[model samples]
Target: MEYKIYVQNLKCGGCAKTITNKLNGIKGVSNLNIYVEDSLVILNCTEIILEKVKETLKKAGYPEDGEQNSLSSKAKSYVSCAIGNIG
Candidate 1:
């Protein structure tokens, strides 16, 4: 199934790239797309892996919308953004 998850701390192409890389690496995820402007991530995966997907997003510092965006999350996002740029 396909899922559309609105996320926070998605600011630019770097964030998008990181999100794309992180999510697409998951075992059950595929055809992932990240919309930086809208803070959206769309992907195809099994229902059973949905929570894992969300957990991965949170760990990458791009927590789903309506979830807490803590200071550490923001900092981790910045780091991820930088790494994304370098990669």
Candidate 2:
């Protein structure tokens, strides 16, 4: 199944790159696409792994839309963004 998850704190190509790398690491995930402009993460994976995907996004500081966007998450996202930019 394919899922479209709108997330928070997506800023630029750096954020997109980080999200892409993170989601693609998931075993059941494929066709990962991150639209930073829209704060969206789209991917194809098994329904069972959907929660894992969302969790991964949150851990990476890109919590799903409507979820908590805490200060810690924003900080983590900035770090992730910098790392993504470097990579």
Candidate 3:
């Protein structure tokens, strides 16, 4: 299965390596792709373990979810508020 995680505060190679090491140790995780620009981590795993994933991400100095990308958040809010408006 493919697992998508939203990550925050990834700034450099060290941050990437840290998260990679923690996740690579997981038995069911086949692959992990981190997209820093969007603060997202795409995981290929047999099992989707959200709690452990969140914990590991926290230990790696990054947190998954509950945070939004600035531009995306603004766009979403705009779209939500614009719904049903008579233009």
Query: What TM-score goes with each of the models?
Result: 0.95, 0.95, 0.65
Clashes of each: 0, 0, 0
Candidate 2 overall Cα lDDT vs. reference? 0.91
RMSD in Å for model 2: 0.7
Per-residue lDDT value at 6 in model 1: 97
lDDT of 3 at 17: 60
Q: How accurate locally, in lDDT, is each candidate? A: 0.91, 0.91, 0.63
Lowest summed lDDT over 10 consecutive residues: which window, candidate 1? 19-28
Residues 54-76, candidate 3: write the lDDT tens digits.
76776545655674346544443
* Per-residue lDDT of candidate 2, residues 1-87 (tens digit): 889999999998988999888888889898888888889888898888999999998999999999999999999999999998999
Ranking by TM-score: 2, 1, 3
Candidate 3 lDDT (Cα, 0 to 1): 0.63
Clashing pairs in 3: none
